[model samples]
Target: GFQFQMGDGGAFEMMGGGPRRKKPKFPKGVPKDIAKSMNWLKGTEWNWNSWRNVKFDKDGTFDAPTHDCQGGFCRWSASPEGKVYILWGDAGLHELQVQGAMPKEQDQAKMQGLRMKGRRTSDGERCQATFQRVFDFEAAELERDLYGILGLPDDAEEADIKKVYRKLSIKYHPDKNP
Candidate 1:
């Protein structure tokens, strides 16, 4: 038997008690940034209305209820800039354009908070099937030079971007100084 605990920032802490639990190793050749994105996605439940919810796991595996198959496994992937690509057994290929910073290391809690905030509805209100669709369309668009802010080259790896972001956050986050 195994127990899952929600750790700080909404990530699950595995069944271990220690000063520092070991992080799972990603498969070889997977970029750290991509691995981090995948880890954030894994084990997190997603819902599109009440019937189309799914939970992705390691190695891009997921189980979803579909009309044709009753229920079957599926696969998913994310782009560098955070677009989601899904290959459901019945629906063929679907691409989702996610607006905002893509999920990355140490940002799981923040991202989760945003999602929760967006999905809040008054009691007795049914969740809209077009929630994500409407939200993506209505989100305030922004144009920023991300590479310029990070002082990185256009082709910088995800790991490098993360390192710089952590350093900058430590230096500039309001709570850090106060």
Candidate 2:
């Protein structure tokens, strides 16, 4: 029998082992800063753009889907100019997505306003890295309120929704009203 002792005062006995390895010990107490950070991380959200996007309340908590999305809470935005990023935040921003006609793939790269960052941090370094865009909606801010704002039901049909949208658009047109 081979007996090994770990740095944290734990010992383990092994049978027929070539090299002795120490058993890992659990920390007696978590650091206060680390504990606080972990608590905040628990509130962090990673949204997956399935077909139905996530909705948030006034307090920034999850609500419900805005509309009956087809594919899932789908992610269609991108940065070809290599500007958009997935950053680690010390204090995050209120991110939101706007629905519009998607630009051509080349034009998407020039859409520089789509940049995203983790919450602001004064003490940390700004580390940048490039990643192939997959389903990285962790920082996505989706707008799930268009249907609600229009006073339409969540299951409103496309034709009905479009008609309402046009009516509202014309009513709110600055050039026409002014």
Best candidate according to lDDT: 1
Off by over 4 Å in 2: 1-144
lDDT tens digits by residue: candidate 1, 18-100: 45323232233423232333345544556655456555444565445664323434565655555455555544444454445
lDDT of 2 by residue, 145-168 (tens): 457769999899999999998998
Task: Report every candidate's CA lDDT.
Answer: 0.47, 0.33
- Worst lDDT window (10 residues) for model 1? 132-141
Residue 134 shift from truth in candidate 1, angstroms: 24
Relative to the unseen true structure, what is the Cα RMSD of model 1? 17.8
Q: Please give the lDDT score at residue 171 for candidate 1.
A: 100
